[model samples]
Target: MAEETVSCPVKIHMTTEIFQEETEKIELVLFGHYYEKGGSAYLKYEEMQEAGKIHTVVKVASGRALVMRSGAVSMRLDLREGSRRPGTYENGYGQFPIEAAADEIVHTRTGSLSGQLSLGYRLYMHGDSVGTYKMKIHYEEVQAAK
Candidate 1:
C-alpha cells in the first residue's frame, strides 16, 4: 500500500472590542498551547503597540506524533491588548513569528485521537499614567494556505 502524508501551516487572526472603565495603562499577552512541542507559543501584545511591529510565531508539528484516524485539538489565548514599554506612549500594532521544537514532551502509551491546547498572555500597566484604551488586533494572510 502506498503511504501519503500532508503538511501545512495554520494561521489565526482575531479582533477584540474592549471597553475601558478606568484610564490606566495596561499590558497584554497572547499565546496558544497545543499537543505539539513549541505547540505552545506566546507574544507580548504591549510590545506590538510600541514598536509598531506585529508579534507572531510559527508552530511546528511534534516529531513524536501518534498516528491516529480522528482526534481533536484545543487552543487557549488572551485577548488583552495594551502598551507596557517604558518612556513611550506611542501605540501601534503588528505581527510576529513562533516556532516549536521536537521531542519536547516524553509521554506516550497510546496515540489518542484527541488533542488539547492552552494559550494566553499577561496584561499589566507597566508604566506611565492611568488610562483605558480599546484595541483590536487584525491579521492579514501573507502566505497562501495549502
Candidate 2:
C-alpha cells in the first residue's frame, strides 16, 4: 500500500541542552509546517539569529533522523541510535567537519496531528568532542479558528 502525504500548519516547541564545561539551555517556539511523506515526517521552520535567518528542516524516520540547515548557518546532521554519522557545518567564516554519535533516539506519535521526538547525542568538531547534547521537539498541528 502507498502511503498518503499529509501537510498542515504547526506550532513547535523545541528545547536543547548542551553539557560541556557547563550546562547551556536554549528554547524556541516556532510556527512552521509539518508534513509526512514517503514514510517520514518533516518539520520545516526558520530561525532568526544575530547573524541572519536560518532555514531548518527536520526529518524523522523509523530509527533515525536528519537535520538540515541553510542560510546564515549550514549543516546536516544524521543521527541514529548507537552510530556515528559524519557531516559538515559552515557559516560566514568557514566550514568544518562535524559528527554526531547518537546515544538514544526516540520518536513518539501522540495523535494523528501531534508528535514528539527526543534525541541524545554527542557532538564532535574536527575530531574533538564538543559536548553531550539532548534535543526535544514537540509539535502539534494548528487548529483553525472558529
Candidate 3:
C-alpha cells in the first residue's frame, strides 16, 4: 500500500519556557504539509520573523523525534526515548552547544494525517542542566474556501 499524504493550511503555535522563568510565545498561520512513509511521518513548515525566515522540519519515527530549523536561528534537536543528544544553537552573534535529554516524546495522529505532539525534556547548556521544558503542538487541516 502507498503511504498517505496531506497538504493544507496550518496554524502553528509555539511556546518556549526557559529556566522555568522566561517564557516566549509565537503563533503563525501558514501552509504546511504532512506525510507518512517507511514507518515515519514528517511535518514541513516555515516561520517568518523579523530577522529572516525559518524553515522547520519535524520527523517522527518509532520512539524518536527530530526537529530541525534553518534560518535566522538554527538548531537540530534529537528527542529519543531515554536518550541524550547534543545540538548546536546558532545565531548571528555566536553559537553554543546544547544538550537535550527527552523524558517523554509522543506524536499521535487523531485523523488520517492530523494530530498533536507533546514532548518533555531537560535542557543543558555548557554541560550544566539549565531547565526542564514541555512543548505541545496541535494542528489540523484547514478547510478550503468555496
Candidate 4:
C-alpha cells in the first residue's frame, strides 16, 4: 500500500534550564509534512533564521522515536529516549561539541503523528552539566498542501 501524505503545521516551544538556575526559551512556527514509509511515521520540517538554518525530522516506529536535526545546527543530532548523543550546535562563530541526553520522552508512537511532544533532556559541554531542557511540539494535519 502507498503511504498517505499530509501537511503538518506545527508550533514548537522549547525551554532550556541550566544548572537549576537559568532558563532559555524558543518558540517557532513552521510547516512540515507527514508520511508513513516502511512501517514508520516521518515528519520533516526546515528551520531557518537569518544566519542559521536546520532541518528537523522525527521518525517513529514500534513505540520508539528519534528526533534528528541537521543542516545549520552544523551537526546532526540523533536523539532517542534515555540516550545521550554527541553533536554540535552551530552559529556564525563556529562549532562546539554538545551532548544531548533525554531522560523522558513523551509522544504517541502509534497512529497519526499529531498533538504534543514533550522532551526532557540535558545538555553537556566540555563534560560539564550546562543545562536541562524541555521541548514541546504541537502538530496538526492540514487538509491540503499550501
Best candidate, lDDT: 2
In candidate 4, where is summed lDDT lowest over 10 consecutive residues?
10-19
List the global CA lDDT of all models: 0.26, 0.92, 0.77, 0.66
Query: Over the stretch 74-123, how does candidate 1's per-residue lDDT look in tens digits?
Result: 11222212322222112223222212122122222122212222222222
Better of 2 and 3 by lDDT: 2
Question: Best to worst by TM-score, what's the order?
Answer: 2, 3, 4, 1
Tens-place lDDT per residue, model 3, 1-146, is 76565455655555544445665544455567676767777778887888799988888887888889899989888888898899887889788889899887888778865687777788888998888877777767767689
Ranking by lDDT: 2, 3, 4, 1
Clashes of 3: 0
Clashing pairs in 4: none
Total backbone clashes of candidate 1, pairs 3 or more residues apart or in separate chains = 20
TM-score of every candidate: 0.24, 0.94, 0.81, 0.70
Best by TM-score: 2
Across 1-146, the per-residue lDDT of candidate 4 in tens digits comes to 86555445443433333445756677777777766677666777888867577887877655356667767565545566667788676666787888878776666533365666666677787888878877666666655556
Better-scoring candidate (TM-score), 2 or 3: 2
- Model 2 off-target regions past 4 Å? 1-4
